[model samples]
Target: MLMTSEWAIILDEVDELSNMILSSEQAHSLRHAYTAVYKDEELAVEIAAFQRMKDHYEDVQRFGKYHPDYHTIMKKIREQKRALDLNERVAALKIAENDYQDLLDEVSLLIGRSVSDAVKVPVSNPFFASSGSCGTGCGTGGGCSCSS
Candidate 1:
């Protein structure tokens, strides 16, 4: 798709934001936090517990069994996952990563919407479709008069 100058500017800003986000140590920390936590026995235990509960849930769902402790297991799984997510340095890094990602998404959405709006004019409408600045006949040896 051809981006208008405005959208191009916005995309450039988004790219800079992305570069800034990924270049920081916090981003690096966020990217590796999960694996780092899993290497620690204390933190790893919570991850294992969460996985076990998830497996149990899947089994219950697969077999269509009414496990009496399903609710309790789910609660424990959430708690364990929460604990892993809130591990001090990891939490801060993850928050930074998430916030930066949201910003990037917003900018991308804005550019996409603008591009969509710019292209909304029908192909049959020459006044809205063509730039009207073509010096030669549509650059195709007298094809269409307007710059299609």
Candidate 2:
């Protein structure tokens, strides 16, 4: 006969643990298509491992909830739930790191393309001179204005 408080705590912990596992799975899916410089695959593997741990904890919780010694079992389940919470935090951190790296890669690519275009454009091009100077005085304060 579990107390109401104990049952409430158990249900809360179970919900939290389930949410963590689902979040980790989503992160893993994101990493599957990622081929950035960061080791997203490794992070995905770690997330998967944590998800498995959460699942194992869930199984223990289910079994313990039905045991005759409900109080003791509930306590153990709470501890396991706490561990699952910690693992979820780790997975979240990994996901954040991977996302940041992906963003960095995208920015780098954009910058690289811009730089490449700048280098390829000839200096005689009026559009390049105007655009680069922002309509400011070009080539020494409008000293050499291109009127072509």
Candidate 3:
């Protein structure tokens, strides 16, 4: 397959972006925060508890609301979710992860717009939720106005 000069340049630019991502401050912070989260024994216990509760909930889901332990499973799941969500280490890790993701998203948006507004870019802006065809998970789809 023959590759055009423009496509070759685009590929080189993307490679540069990947290098930037590797050295970005957010990437370092994300790794540090992720390590901290895993090193904390308290957080690990909470995560384990949450996983167990989730497994229990799935097991009960087969019986639907008719299960005798449905109410108990629901209550436990809520409790576990709250415990995990409220952890400071987990929260910090999430912030770091989002920061890194924001950098990547900005790069993608820039590349997309450089080509055309009709080009879809996946963005995970916390403040500005897109009505575009890039869903919450950030994937391109038809009829998207994701690029800016």
Candidate 4:
């Protein structure tokens, strides 16, 4: 039976540990994506090892039920889960930001290509003749021809 203060401390530590794991996982995934882009097998292996450590931490929490500090540990585990949930929300936001940045890049490329294509085409002004007179009569020097 753990004292209330001791249990509180344990729970706090568990929450902190959980936050650490979640933050590490998020960083790992981001780095993994970046490394995969560069085809870095060594970094991939390192990331896998980190993932295994995270799994081991989860296993420790699961088997904590058999320990004398079961209640305290379980409470801590629940707090950890809450911390993980918050981490996931943050990771999602980062992913969304990346996606938005990619979209902007694509749109910028498309606009550049479109503008280039447009520049390649010949533009015609229907109101201007080869003699540089306006077709609209006002500037044609025809004295605004009208029958009314």
The per-candidate count of clashes, in order, stands at 0, 0, 0, 0
lDDT values of the candidates? 0.60, 0.51, 0.78, 0.48
Question: lDDT score of model 1?
Answer: 0.60
lDDT (C-alpha) at residue 36 in model 1: 64
On TM-score, the leading prediction is 3
lDDT tens digits by residue: candidate 1, 1-148:
7889999998898889779767766667566764666567876676677778888777766645367776776677677777777787557656756655555444444454567633322222233234432322245653656434
Query: In candidate 2, residue 2 scores what lDDT?
Result: 55
lDDT of 2 at 69: 56
Per-residue error (Å), model 2, residue 26? 16
Q: What is the lDDT of residue 89 in candidate 4?
A: 40
Angstrom error of the Cα, residue 111, model 4: value is 23
Question: When superposed on Cα atoms, how far off is each prediction in RMSD?
Answer: 14.8, 25.4, 4.2, 30.4
**Residue runs of model 1 more than 4 Å from their true location after superposition:** 1-21, 24-29, 32-41, 61-65, 117-148
What does the lDDT read for residue 11 in candidate 3? 95
lDDT comparing candidate 3 with the true structure:
0.78
Backbone clash pairs for candidate 4 read none
Cα lDDT of model 4 by residue, 1-148, tens digit: 8479989997897688556544654555666655443365554454455456556556666776675666764565566555543554434545744654444344344444556632221113232222232222344344544211
TM-score (C-alpha, index-matched) for candidate 2: 0.23
Candidate 3, which segments miss by more than 4 Å at Cα? Answer: 3-10, 126-148
> Which digits, one per residue and each the tens of the lDDT, describe model 2 over residues 51-105?
6665666666676757565665456556755664465444555575566444434
Candidate 4 regions off by >4 Å? 1-38, 64-148
When summed lDDT is taken over every stretch of 10 residues in candidate 4, the lowest stretch is 120-129
Residue-wise C-alpha lDDT for candidate 3, range 1-148, written one tens digit per residue: 7899999998998788788898899999999998998888878877887888899899999999999999999988998888777888888999999999888777777666678766656567844336332535444543345443
